[model samples]
Target: MTPKHVQINKQIKLHFALLFVSCILATYLSGPSLSSMPLLQWLLTGLFFAGISVLPLLFFIPTVMAPNARNLSWLGFFLLAYLVWGVVKIFSPNGLIGGLLVCTFILTTFFYTVIWLRPLKKAAKARQQLEQD
Candidate 1:
């Protein structure tokens, strides 16, 4: 795989892992307060993060690992939406656990933004010229 593809793959994996961890952390931290509706609360927390992180990921995976992958700049906008949410959470009053959860969300969104901005075509062109020698 090309270097750009490698970077994108790594970023996706990292972001997904972080999102999952954030979901679990959120569920745990809010569990007690949600004791009456434990199942629903946890499920919704997980689903919300999954929807923001994994759902858009579907559009990225097919081309993320391909050398000639077309640029999906549009995906970055979707990710930015999550970033905004994270920022809002960070600023909002919350306890220690809530702070950590927001941090994780921020990290995931930052990495995704980096992935989306990768100079794929430029790198591909450079690689192609080098290979033709």
Candidate 2:
């Protein structure tokens, strides 16, 4: 496999690992109290959904969309928005450890966004320029 493929695989593994660890940690931290059960359940469910939802978008969407600069730009915008949301949650009074997790999430998302989008953007721009020529 090419280096790009290898990198993508590595990223996928990392994302899964992070998601798993985060969910486990969240559950553990929530404690055994009845009051915490609802919160833990909600958190685990959210994490599960997020992990499942993002995989298809990240790995499959480009296959149909003709990966281009515009698509990448949109992805970047989404990443930025996701990061912002994490930051906002982190700053909220209820977020404590949640804030730290958000920060980590932001960092990971930012890294993957830049890595994946840069090549797509470059290739798209090149394609556009070629068509215009």
Where is the poorest 10-residue window by lDDT in model 1? 63-72
Strongest candidate by lDDT = 1
Task: Report the C-alpha lDDT of model 2 over 40-127, residue by residue, as the tens digit.
Answer: 6866765665565345335534521343445555655665665565566556565556546745754674576467666666878999
Against the true structure, candidate 2 reaches a TM-score of 0.52
Residue 60 Cα positional deviation in candidate 1, in Å, after optimal superposition:
6.2
Runs of candidate 2 exceeding 4 Å displacement: 23-79
Error of 2 at 106 (Å): 3.0
lDDT of every predicted structure (CA atoms): 0.56, 0.54
Once superposed on the true structure, which residue ranges of model 1 sit more than 4 Å away at CA? 27-72, 95-100, 103-109, 112-117, 121-133
Clashes of each: 0, 0
The per-prediction CA RMSD against the true structure, in angstroms, equals: 6.0, 6.0
